[model samples]
Target: MMTILDALYLLVGIMFAATAIINLRDSLNSKRWKSAGFWGINAIIFIFGRYLPPLANRILVIVMVLLAGLGGLGRSGKPETSLEQREVRASRFGNRLFIPMLLIPLVTMLGTFAFKSLTWNGALLIPAGSSTLAPLAAGHDAGNGAGGRRKPLVWRRSRLSGLGAGGG
Candidate 1:
């Protein structure tokens, strides 16, 4: 049976692969190729490192460290949003924005206990090494949902703050 970590790793691998593709297409970044390579390697590591030999995994990690230490990584010159827009959003959201962050720990604690005895086919639901991470991932999901308009508590607070139905 696959562990929860396997699913999370696949998701992270996809994200890293997307980053690698973005870096590869970033003409403005002088080190675009290096950046792409770095992220591509990270994607491979996350996706397939478990199946690789220990020595190979170590070599890949060393390569990543060397690349980072040698300033091989770079970002595209463009940003999706400007600093001013970010500040404006921050001000617009106010303290209610912090609700998601606060819920993370609480959700993690609850999920840890909730998942502790969960099972499938008599196997432990979470891998031994990922006892903490599995619940933490669930917490992240809960936190994201907690701040949404659908939730009763946040809906009233969001309305009172006049945030309306605007996306954060």
Candidate 2:
């Protein structure tokens, strides 16, 4: 059983995914306006639904349905020519290319794990007396108040030695 917040999160995630797919489809086909108003309303519900009294989300849903109906009736009647059909064919080819793009997320996940391991080993390989880690050692020593002096770590140049010059 999921909590209300969990359900709402799932609902919002699905709506956003659907909106992304619709927008991509519209872009490929060169459509002027992608109807993402439903997604906008879903985002609002995700943010403010908990604060409102009962039935607020349902009322919003009803309003969206009415708006969609009105928008459907407002489309201009345009006959398609062979040129438009060729454009649609090209768009379909573009849509087919979208599937291979899934490899990007897979590669990113692999790279993240590999880089995390490399960074872990790099931190472990830091030699004692290395100037690069002097500030970190000082910060650790200050935290414990080394040599019986209980002075708090001052925010001076020593505190920032390990931070490279490209601080920005």
Candidate 3:
């Protein structure tokens, strides 16, 4: 029997593939071959790692871990909007910025609660088998679109990690 977990892995693979395409475009624009290669391999791994033999999966995991530890990934250098320009935008768009942020959660929650229509056979049209994954995946894709590419900063929204502290 296929489970929602299986569906989620497929969705994750798709997301990684999409990200790889974005990374490739960024690389093409900026001549960042390493960035392209990195995300490209990540896409492959996300899509195929489950199908690979255990040893191969372990090796890929090790390599990815090393690359991350060595800081092989770099950010797009497109100048972030200058703070002065940002201040102006913020002043002009005050409270509007919050709309983008709130939209993700709103859509996710709505999807979680209302997306799974009851089928004639009684199973949902969309699986909400993993309650958390449904909303999270919805929000994640939305967040990625609205947030776009920016410098790497610790995700502080969760109380898991922070400056000089373990995530746990």
C-alpha RMSD by candidate, in order:
7.6, 22.8, 8.1
Best by lDDT: 1
> In model 3, which runs have C-alpha deviations exceeding 4 angstroms?
1-8, 25-31, 103-129, 142-168
Model 2 steric clash pairs: none
Cα lDDT computed for each candidate against the true fold:
0.73, 0.43, 0.57
Candidate 3 residue-wise lDDT, 101-137, digit = tens: 7867887788677655534467655555655566667
Please give the range of 10 consecutive residues that has the lowest summed lDDT in model 3.
159-168
Candidate 1 stretches greater than 4 Å from native: 79-83, 141-168
Worst 10 residues of 2 by lDDT: 159-168
lDDT of 1 by residue, 1-168 (tens): 567778988877887787787678768778888888888989999999999999998998899888888989865554345457666878988897898888899888887887777788998878765667777877776776866748432343233334332211
lDDT for model 3 comes to: 0.57
Please estimate how well model 1 matches the true structure, expressed as its whole-model Cα lDDT: 0.73
